[model samples]
Target: MGSMDRGLRALVGIGLIAWGVTAQNWWGAIGIIPLFTAAIGWCPAYLPFGLSSCKTPK
Candidate 1:
């Protein structure tokens, strides 16, 4: 996960949590957890697949 991706994930997580709390839907909040993880540049789900977008030094 690149810096940009991490940043986006953080934003999405926050949005989902906000929506879930305000809308009274725990599911939404729960869904945001994954996004939050991705945003932080770490994805549990991607581990099995060996997926990573983080830029490497040229």
Candidate 2:
């Protein structure tokens, strides 16, 4: 994944987690997916379609 993609995912993950905490619900647990992916710099969902946000070198 690219830096921008990772950053966005991290932000979204944090937001979801915060929302879950404030609402005191299990739904926030879903945020872990993005957070984990961002940390690992890999997204399984992108593999099948051969998609990537990273820029290719010349």
Candidate 3:
């Protein structure tokens, strides 16, 4: 993933986790999906659709 995508995911994941913690809901754990993908620089959901947020290097 591109830097922008990673940053966005990080922001969203953190928000979800924080919301979950304060709200005492386990659903916040779902944020792990985006966090994981950002950390690994890859998203499984993108694979099936052949979608990539990263720009190709010239």
lDDT of each: 0.76, 0.99, 0.89
- Backbone-clash count (model 2): 0
Q: Write one digit per residue (lDDT tens) for candidate 3, span 1-58.
A: 8899999998898889889999999999998888887888888888899998988989
1 or 3, which is superior by lDDT?
3
Model 1 Cα displacement at 52 (Å)?
Answer: 0.9
Going through the candidates in the order shown, the clash numbers are 2, 0, 0
lDDT of 1 by residue, 1-58 (tens): 7777777777777787888888998866675775767755688877999988788899
Off by over 4 Å in 1: 35-40
Off by over 4 Å in 3: none
Q: After superposition, how far is residue 55 of candidate 3 from its true place, in Å?
A: 1.3
- Overall local distance difference test of candidate 1: 0.76
Candidate order by TM-score, decreasing, is 2, 3, 1
